[model samples]
Structure formats: C-alpha cells, structure tokens
Target: MIWQGRSRRKPTGGLYRPHRKKRKYEMGRPQTETLIGERKIKLERVRGGNYKVKLVRDKYANVYVPSEGKVVRVEIKRVVENPAHVHYARRNVITKGAIIETEIGLARVTNRPSQEGLINAVLIEQK
Candidate 1:
C-alpha cells in the first residue's frame, strides 16, 4: 500500500529504543554468594572482574596464619592469593602457605589433589 505525505520506511535515526524483558528462570530471585565470618570484604559487583583486598587494621598488630600445628602471627601477612592459597611476606622475604587458616579454622588446601576421590586437609580447630 502507498502512503500520502509520509513514507512507510522505518526511521533510521535518534529515538531511544526500549529493552525487552523476559521471565526465563524457573526459580525466584537470583542467587548471590554469602560471605561468612568477616563481612568487611567488598568485591566488585560485576562477574569475572578481579578484586584486591587490603588490610585496614592497625599496622602494629599482625595477622595470624596457622602452620602445621602452631599459628604464625607474622608482622606482615595477608591474603595474597584467592580462596585457598595465601602468601605471607616480611621485608623482602615471602613464604607461600603449605597450610592456611580459613573462616572455620586451619586446613591444608591446594589447587589439585592426589588419589581418586581422596582429598587432603581438614579443619584443625578443637572440639
């Protein structure tokens, strides 16, 4: 069909286009991660983005990272690595964790494990 004054061609210009909304998920609201123990950490809201957590506590006091049986309250210790591994450093000396302390307690964690279905390390905290 032909028009009188205006053409039937779609406008190829400046008006803002509205977004389409869809209800696809079977469940309710989206799930989010819950941080236990320390809630001080604030990470980036966007997924896949990197976050760097720094110590805000007094410099005089130190953090304690457990080792073997005893805990090492080194002057300069922080969560240098994510989730499992942590790095502790003082002066120019740096030592990676053979064992580490988590929100629950101390445990020996690694990226990979040996043996089939066999995992190492458990919480060292007392009952």
Candidate 2:
C-alpha cells in the first residue's frame, strides 16, 4: 500500500503530535504501468463502490485526425515522446500526454491509458 499522509515528523526532523487517524481519502493506490503490447486490461475496485479499468498492455489507439473529421483505430508503432518522463518514452510506457508514432502519423495522447483502458490521441501536424 502507498502512503498518502503527511509525515509525523516536522521539517526540522522533530516528531509532531498526531491529530487524527488515517482516512480513506488519504489512501494511495499502486502505480499502474501501461506498456506497449497486446491488448490487456485489469479491473480494480475503487472506493465509493466504483470499478476502474486499467490497461496493462495496449496495441491500438483511437486516433483523431482533424483532416478526416473522424476517429480511426491505428496500431501503435512506438512511443515518440512522453512529457511525464524521458525514461517512460524510451521504455514505451504509455501514459497521458505521451506522443506516440502510429501507422497514421504522430499523435499526442489525450487520455489516461491505465485508468481508462483505452488510448485516445489527437494527430499532430508533421513538419
């Protein structure tokens, strides 16, 4: 489990008195690493009686081309850039705001792949 609460120690390294117990809202979930591969999804039961679809591996992305005025499914070739992290881009880790190369062209990811179990991107104009 991940810790989402403030530390008991102060900035000066002095112990501080506890005011309250940990709450559900302060809970943290594990990091879901979505990778480029065959399509795969994992279901997670979240708080408030809701379920979330986590994409473990995705091969296709729904790319929206402005010129076409419609969305098209394209095979993901590789990750081009990831604003989240450079390492993630090199690792081909799919995440929100990641730029990926597809059969159609380069597209910027607009959705959270791990949380939505789907990759949605908007095509970028090539120079």
Candidate 3:
C-alpha cells in the first residue's frame, strides 16, 4: 500500500539535506575564506539558523549586528539589497536591530546567494 501512494508524492525542494554524513563539519563554519587577518564570527540567520564569516575582508558582509543596547561601533561584512543598504563606495557600516537609529544607515546581510562563506547572518559588532 505504501508503494502505491509513493508515485503521487511531491517534492518541496526546500533545503539541500544530504542523506549521509558530510565529509567535514558543516555548521558554524564559513564556506569561504575571509581577509588575510580578519576574525570571522558566527551569525544567526532567520531561516537556516546559524552561519559564519569574517569582519575585515568583506566588511560589507561581517559587521552590523542587531543593536543590543546603545549605539556603538559595529563592523560590517555583507551589504544587502534594500533601502537599508548603502553604496559600497561611499557607505561602510550599518546599525543592526532597533530600526536603525542614527543617519549611519543600514545594510542588509548578504544572504549566501552567490559566494560560499555567505550566510543569512552579518558579522556585527561584538560590544
């Protein structure tokens, strides 16, 4: 009876889940390399949950964490595509969380749409 209904089954094509164990550890690791001497931090994505990256090499993708408390210095690693996003040439940092207070502006985290190290998270300021 199980085999009969199997034919009508449909695929969701949501996440790419591998059947067997991964050759190496997947979670909490950056898919790509960061700048020569930058420290990458693990970021939390809304969907997948967590990912990792650096703060120097790709400032656009790294900094800009959810503002936990008052305004402070936050490094940016990835730049997103939205009104919150700024030009790569002129703009640099972003204020995560709290609806972006200062004119400092905001940038969206580069969802790993292209490169390897990319995750839905941003390498924001630690403080």
Candidate 4:
C-alpha cells in the first residue's frame, strides 16, 4: 500500500530518523482513473465515521450552461482535453479541468469525479 504520510527527508536535504512506525491511517490507495462507461461506484470507509463514494466509471455529466442559467444532464461523448495528463485524453480518463464532448457541446469538468462520485461540468462551446 502507498503511504500518505510525510516524507523522511527534510527541506534542507537532510534525512531524518524514524520517529514512529507507519500507521494504517497513513496508508493510501491507488488513484481512481475514472473512465467513460456504464455507471460504477465504490464505497470506501474513510477515517472518521464517514464514507467516500469513489467513481470508477460513468457516462453522463451534469453540465451547467451559463446561457440557460440551469444545469442539464447530458451524455458524455468523449474526452477532448485533459490538463492533468497528456495521455489522459487519449485514454478517456476523466478528471477535473478536463474538456469533454457532450451531447450539448464541449464542456469543462469542474469537479473531481473520482472523489465526488459525480461528473459536474460547465458548458464551454456549443455544438
């Protein structure tokens, strides 16, 4: 498992001795690469008594249109551009700041779908 704790190195490039062993709470999981497909989600129990809804795959998005002043549910056609990674666009991995092709038009993802379990985007250019 990946560790989410602080690094062992200091800002001055000095190595620091271990103060204590790693705890389970400090562990991390793999990244959720959300893709366009049939809806799929995972429920994860996080710290505190809460749960995290991880989105694995989805095909629709709630696109907000400024001209209409309302949100509309639209089908995602494909990934256009992903600022997070160059290959993400080709792989169709959805992430925040990614431009996607939807039934309404081109839209920019405004939220982290993998973390929010939903895709929210703002209409950019109309079809």
lDDT of 4 by residue, 3-106 (tens): 56678899999998988987888777788999999999999888997998999999999999998799999999999999999999999999999999999889
Per residue, candidate 2 scores C-alpha lDDT tens digits across 1-127 of: 4466667799999999988887877777887889999888999988887999999998999999998799999999999989888799889998899999999889999999899989999999765
- Stretches off by above 4 angstroms in model 4 are 1-3
TM-score of every candidate? 0.19, 0.86, 0.18, 0.89
What is the lDDT ranking, best to worst? 4, 2, 3, 1
Better of 1 and 2 by TM-score: 2
The residue pairs that clash in candidate 4, if any, are none
lDDT of 2 at 112: 93
Residue lDDT tens for model 1, 1-127:
3232333344775554434443343223332221112223323233256443321121111233344543332222222223322322211111222243444444443312211111133334565
- Top lDDT: which candidate number? 4
lDDT of every predicted structure (CA atoms): 0.30, 0.91, 0.36, 0.94
Candidate 4 worst ten-residue window by lDDT: 1-10
Cα RMSD of all models vs. native, in order, equals 17.5, 2.6, 15.1, 2.5
Residue 3 C-alpha lDDT in model 2: 61
Whole-model alpha-carbon lDDT for candidate 4:
0.94
